[model samples]
Target: MQLIGRDAETGVLEEFLGRVRAGESHAFALVGESGAGKTALLQHIAERASGCLVVRVEGVQPEADLAFAGLYQLLTQLPVRFDQLPAAHREALRTAAGMRPGSLNWLAISLAVRHILFAASDKQPLICLVDDEQWLDHASVHVLAFTARRLGTRPVGLVFASREPSSEIAGLPFLKLNGLTDSAARALLDSTLAAPVDPAVRDRIIADAHGNPLAILDIPDEPLGGFALPLVTKDEWHLDTLPDETRRLMQVAAADFVGDPVLVWRAADKLGIAARAANPAIEAGLLELDTLVRFRHPAMRRAAYWSATLPQRQEIHQALGDVTDQRTDPDRRAWHHAHATPGPQEAIAAELERCTVRAQSRGGLSAAAAFLERAAILTPEPAQRARRLFAAAAAKHDAGARNQALELVAAALAGPLSAGERAKAEQLRDQLRTATSLMDEVRRAVEAGGNTDEVCIESVLEAWRGVEPTTADDYAKAVLYNGIGRHDAARDAALRALHTPLVITELAEAAARTGHFDLVKALPDPVGDWASGIQARIDALLTEGAQADAHHRDSITYLDRTHVRIELARAHLLYGEWLRREHRRIDARAQLRTALEIFTSMGAEAFSTRAQRELRATGETARKRTQPNHNTLTAQETQVAQLARDGLSNPEIGTRLFISPRTVQYHLRKVFAKLDITSRTQLDRVMLG
Candidate 1:
């Protein structure tokens, strides 16, 4: 196959191979969306790796739970001599590969793989390519990640291709492939077509493809005039032509999100289909068979599943549910049961609810939200469904999927609810809305023509009327009074809301703003790391130069929670104001601009406006606020730049951030490029300007 539109990616792979040949080790992850040429790029690298000993493994969903599945595949391909390794290393590898009777040890397996790869590199530089790393077994992923990190100066290269995000690689260097450029897509289309295409039709195809090379080639040769091309549906193009049995197998494969072939085949066997029935689809490029069955792309999986009738899909789910082990994979079993039961199955809903709890216990908020959403769909009672929807919304909110959380809240509101449930829903809606649109909410509250103090007091009284008032309710009252210029009342309400450390910090700020300096000093120490953070801000405001700077640094190091990110933003704003007063205009401008960027991005309208005012006071015109650019420096980059400007060297910055000096240099290089400056001296001007 002729590869097109991956010059930059191919160049990076070539460089990695060159370094490996020169006795240096390297690891890179190729991350992109499905059908974005990740697999193609990996294949191109393998073909071009002339003298290197290449070993390849592709992760299968069904085998993800099978210990050492990916690692076993890679190790088997290497010409390794078992007798050459140390006895412990040899036994560990043998045990992990199931050639010996012993439990698998993670450290021994990792060391064994590392030693084998290093030994192979002495004969020829070794290159290990792992495709679809998201589906790799947890054990294999951990071992390979360990080996990749410890390669040191060995002549080996580890490269991975994944459609998922960078989380799988654990901070390994990665090259992300976006859609091809317009010219590249056009050139690919030109070469792909057998006959000359009409200029008008060509233009339409180019536009419809949207720079995806695969989509452009998948366009049919029929009349193109007035014909609509689905942008992302090309992966399903040839599926309808497959045999019924093959198509059925594809649907079953699609039904399992993990693509576990064991479960798929088990379900297929229950349906009286032979294993050979899936070969047609596999040959047609619609599916692939490894340790598990997989669709060629995620879109194909969706197409296969959606193409089946609801009854047919329910039958497939029933088969899968029956075969799935209840104890070993209760989440998957519950999920299958939820889908298999037609409507309003209380048993299935309860099972999914239990799964949601388990997911929450593991800190999988997104997974918990998904389970609750499914439970809501399967719930028979109206009130129970409403509660599930509300719970799912809350989980989504905690997971930072704010827009989806609001949508779920709206869905919950449309259903039946008791008065308390209704109040909770309304409160949640108000809280989420206030976080993103405080200015709008405040304007609406004021325009209602009620006395600000009376309304604030009424809200507080109504909230307290409940069996127990929540901190949220008290915080709302504080914000309402603060927005209306009732500083004393705001301070009082803020103090009442001091339940969590975050709320204590909020109260401290409100007290300081109301000229209650004594109250700020007298505030009880908040629990957790935030105690240091809140104290740091208080100390910065109350103390002198060097001590104040130390406080600010401590505050920055302790700020991590999303809900309290605004406090971090406030710290930067206060630090900038202090620097400006001290005539450190350059440093002040950088800090002020960072605060403005964070405030605007978070939709804190009042604070962002305040930051803009501060920037102007520092003698730099605040440009008209625009949507944040995706390419702009990240929060970590901004922090690193600020610390560097404060006269910290790479090692000092690394110590403060808890990263290696090399990592610090790497981040600085990226910071310098993003700010379009050559040296640290230019950072303040370029970053602030």
Candidate 2:
């Protein structure tokens, strides 16, 4: 098939291929909607590229949760020698491909895949084409994305086609395919149709197709002058013309999403469908039988699946569930079983909950949220559903999806719940609100003439009622009181929360206004390299001697973790205040400005005000300025950029961050775009300035 209206995209692919042939590496993502010719473009590249070993794999929806399914498909097709890789890598690959009995180690598997691809590319230029990448199993996506990013000096070119945006490959170069241009659309139409139609009908078909090549070809030749139909509707109409058994088989295939012919055939066989039933679908150009069975276009697959009756769809899902291998593909089997059960099923819900936990352990927060959300839907009892919904909300919130978390919390609240469950749901809601409205909440509390000590005590008592007090709870109380200037209460709470001597630094700082210099002197010697301990040592030195400058530098250097961001900001604020007290006005201005930026960005109104006061003491005006867009880079991106500015290569950055080199490059690209700068030299100026 000729690719129409993708000359520019094809050119980019060709250039990448050219680079690979010259022993340079490249990776690109082709992003577009259904019927946007992504598949066609990939096939075009595969056919046109010369002197390269092309390995193609596709994401199958039905097998999305079957870990490493896509990677197995790609690796099995290549001439891979397992003996060439490290034993860990070999074992991981063997486990992933179901050839060995062991847990799947994604890192080991990623390394194995990279080593295999590197060896292959050394023999011949290699091209990897991944189609429908959004449907790829999470494990496979991670490994491939890792390998693609670290191709480095290898003669490899990686290309992916996805219908949805994916954060896994967020920073990769992408070619977005839109609709075909007018001339290209018409040319495609003329080539696709053997017989000429009325000019008016042709014009109408062109307009209705809206430049989608597949939509244009699917239009009926006998269309009347006044007739109109939606693009996918036309494709669904064509599906309606197929025989019952053939159509049902196609519907089953569509629902399979993985488009695996074996699974589809097995499911169809259960429905009494013979192999011949698939012939008609193939003849209709709506189905293809190759390494995998797939619809000609994503739109046709959607149309086929949606065209089935609800009960029939359930039966198909049940059939798939029955055939899926439980050992190797438990998550998908569980999902299919859940979908097949007409109503709530406790067993399926429990299985999905387990899946959610596994996903969370892998840092797949979105996947964990999805699993919990689906588990909630499958829960039979109202209270169980409410609990599941609350769990899902928590997972979503942890994943940085606050809006979705709020929506889930609202849904949980509407469900039948016990008082405890309801309270938990309300608490989650309040937490999310606090994160987004910290400044507003502080202002409201202040305006209402709230006593900081009373409010802090009440909050802690109410939330932790009937439970043993924990170090974390007391710490929260201490922070809350300290924020509102209740030094005595804050000191008391901090002392209670001090589980280890390392935490004495934070407590000492909180108790500074309470004349607790004796408490500071009573602390034991530091034990470990904990940040809290480090900060405390710095604080003790600053308090007792002329080492405030050195301590300030040391405290700031240890402020790296996300959990300690507030402490980092406070360190800057206190250091700025101390600098001002010492008449180091210029240095105080720098520290106070940093503290103000951090506090304002975090919506810490009280801390921001403190920093602003210090700034003014340094003879600087603290203006209420809107946040800069350049500061919107995610924490990971900022880290990557900072490491890059420190002259670390992609692999070095990846090692330090515990991510893949490709991932570092991906985040670096985002950082570059966010800061509107193109190079590492520019990054130092933008970040350090």
Candidate 3:
């Protein structure tokens, strides 16, 4: 079948395939909402895969929790020589596929999959198509994503169709499918119609379907009048009109989830449902029963499932569970039984608890968290429930979902937590909050007139540490140096950078510092509020009192809101210097004192001494320096130092702290400076005591 209105998408895919056939490996994800034809697109790609050996894996909803189930499906299709892989890789693959009695290792499994693909592709180019990837087992998704990223010139093309974008597959190319164009929608609707549709009715259907291919096919069958009917109402109409037996059959099929026709029929038999009951659904275009039970669209299946009463649905699940073979697929059986049982059941909860261990072994933290969460819900005891929730939260945190982890931890804390559990939960909460606050601080610094890059240099370094220096980083360094009044350094860096907003600010500041007022004035107006403040500082150099007063006050007000304390103090110092030059001694002293307090607290020696000199000029005696705090390291710096002291390498420390290795190194330098130590070996002696 020709995919309507996807000529552009098809062209891109054709070009991508041509490159793959020429021995370049590529991976692409098809992202869209349900009914957006992601599955149809995958099917179309398979049809066009003429010379390529196509390997298809469709994620079964019922098998989502079964560790490495999706991987097993895809691997079983490929003709790979296991002996060709290294012993460790072969063992890992064997263990993951349940052919060996051993624990699964995620990294090993990923490497094994990559080797298998490369081996399989030696003779023929391979195209692996994954549909409903969101429903795939988490362990398999991790393995596939890892393999896809490292395929470099392997002549393997991996394509995924998923309802939403996944962070796991981030950095890979994606083709997001939207609704069809208006003309395409009209054409598709015309082809589906038995007779001529009313012009107004046709237009309404087209408008309501929003160019969704599935919606266009389904909407033409709905009754329409001069008055418009909502698309949801039509769906409700279909569900409400189905025969009792047919709806029950749908509920059984939906509840079955694996799309196994034999399993569905067996479960239906257990419920005393006749085979002919599925005929009405088939006739209505809601279901297809042949080799397997298939829904017309995912939406139809969902509607069919939700149409049944809660007890009826549970009964269907129970029947499906009863019919499922425990020895072959215990995880799916346990999940079905858990759903069927309404209240807390110790046996079922224990089964789910055990699943978490297996999931974690396969490096499926997300899957582990889900199992723990479900186990918690099924636990009869409050204490066990709280413990399970806490474990789940920790798993979520390790999976790099801090916000969700925070929510789970908070929920766990609200229950009966032991003293140790309470402390651990609070610590996790603090970590999550600190991470969020750091992001907010950087955002505020950027919006205001602060050194945003200084707050994010570690993140920048982490993202680009091993990569060659781009003009972007040069511009960033120019901005950072300019903020510190290193005009020569700023100028040198600006010379190597492109003409971005940041580079412009750096050039203008460098010129102004060198007394080139004309160049500063000739520079284009700065972009954001923070850049405007930089421009204002240059303007202050040219103007006096009231003309620059408003700009100075604006800078102070804006910078004060951000957590970049050093930058805020600098803003105060600049404004105070201007006030003093204008002979406003009283106003100058106030700003100078504020700057002094912050600079002193942060151990910014130069800025603090500068603030003191300004205060002395205002006729106030410079206050004696407060005794320096024994420990002046910020929380993040301390964390980095402790990890370094514990013998963690920079990259390892960065991983634990969720920063970049470069950022970890930067913090280590600060730690060494504060502790009067030249090497990491001294951290143990100086920091421990």
Candidate 4:
């Protein structure tokens, strides 16, 4: 499907491509909350940028010793003089690249990442794609600035995509994204949601998501309505429902500046220090204690810290690594050994059903697996942990993390687990083994960089070409013709995409993109017709009590809407339409403005230019509607009116001020009418003269 929204981002990318194609240096910093589609957008842009060799290094939050993993991935491929690298980062990147996932030589690894790109040959302008610069090591941070400055005049655009604002990559061309607009969000709901939703309820769901596209589409059900959902800052969650003991443990863990065993112990000690015994909040699932006393989510710790008593709170983060120094337990001592930040959630069961439900709702199957890893680590019983581990592996397989999923499943089945857990793992392991093979093929296909569309077409044609002409293929042809400026061809293709006997999701998407406005649905129902058909269906579904499923289904409409907006931008550019906000949706304009501001702040000239172009074209326009003011009143007229307003009769005013009674009467009448006050007493509320 075509991408929607991201006008500002696409404009910046087009500008970068234009510069690179012309052999100029440019960079773009793509910023958005996680799941705002940064990686997907980057991939699309890279695919389209002419003559640009795109090398992507996805950022993963590694434990301390593995900090430079991203940089290592790049350095391993380039045949560069390790000895010739700048003294500042040469050894650091090399050493870190050689370390394991959970190790901690951050100083060296971080340094290596900074200089890894320096290994790039002056051979060509390379477009390096980096995801999550916010977690980059110090060396990587230093080298990023150096490379950006040193490579000027070379056809290179370092596309840095991040979730949070990073001071390191500040002053580069930035494109910050907010959630999709109501229309975009609705479009997403239309495609993914299985059940129907009422229009009013769907809108309310969007509002709850706070305009964050990922959040709107992911909210599973009302039962966990208030859980930590996306686009919500950590500061917003309410704490009244949580056990006080859970809150206490969380506050303590948050104190160490890091959450490890030593810090947990320190935080726990305080509960007793203040004369309150440490209670069992463990039963409520508020806190976990295996190697360390920790909360399920980082937000949990943050909230506790923020709400803690100031005097005690100040001592918690003991200056980065103070408390765990003297730990004896191998498990608890492990906590103080690393200095990385905590993650969103830490479920101690490998098969995290709650998280999976949330993930599926949000379309984040991969994340569900990652979260379940915590459950694996935190579970007390070996058998329970094994079961969770296997569940996590299976979930990972579903999420396309085939390798990780395969490894986890194998380990669970082969481990010294209980009969039940082991039996489940053995069965799941076989299933995963089969999936892993398909994943291997897909990865190979993705890596070949062959014509993606042709590959897709070949597969579809091989199966269904003879039976009936694929509507999607028909649509593709229309798109190709449209690209050559054939409006009629584009229209026909769009019609085919809409009219073809296809999946409900595909039809809704085609309609939304092609302007068959009636095909779009009002609710999150997947089966909405060409008009308000789906909204009606959603209502029917809701009358029967499938609220959660309805919400789950409705979110896809918004995701699809997001894709369409991106496609929309592509169309506008193709047709030579102005990249301005005037012709765009209000929500699009807002996201674009934010993205533009970020790019501009990043010192990305090309991207900033594009942002400005969009802002100029689409931002609200204020016409020069000036009101010419021309009013005249004599001082005598004012004095007369003032007296008349002071409760004096016209003759009395004339006698007091030595004026003619006729003039006084005239002024009083004018003042009364002009001031819109009939009674003399009302003159106080109005100013006359």
Return the top candidate by TM-score: 3
**Residue pairs in collision within model 2:** 61-257, 62-258, 149-662
Ranking by TM-score: 3, 1, 2, 4
* Each prediction's TM-score versus the true structure: 0.37, 0.36, 0.42, 0.33
**Candidate 4 residue-wise lDDT at 249:** 56
Whichever of 3 and 4 has more TM-score, that candidate is 3
Residue-level lDDT of model 3, residues 1-689, one tens digit each, is: 77889998888889878888999999989998888898888888888889889999988899999988998899889887777789999888888878899777889889888888888888888999999998998888899999988999888999988986468875679998888999999988877764333454466456546688887786523222211112232244376687788889988886665567888899999999999998888898778877667676645665677777779978987898788888865655666777788999888888878766554443245546666767778988888888888987898787656677888899889889899998888777766664554444335544353345433443322211122223346755665555455667767776676444435555666666666656554336555545555566556656666887877766655544434545556667778888888898987876777666555544444456667888899999866775233347755567888989999999899667544465466568767877888999988898853
* Full-model lDDT, candidate 1: 0.71
Worst 10 residues of 3 by lDDT: 222-231
User: How many clashing residue pairs are found in candidate 4?
Assistant: 64
User: How many backbone overlaps does candidate 1 show?
Assistant: 1
Query: Higher-TM-score candidate among 1 and 4?
Result: 1
Model 3 stretches with alpha carbons more than 4 Å out: 1-237, 359-363, 438-556, 561-689
Which regions of candidate 2 are displaced past 4 Å?
1-237, 358-363, 414-424, 434-689
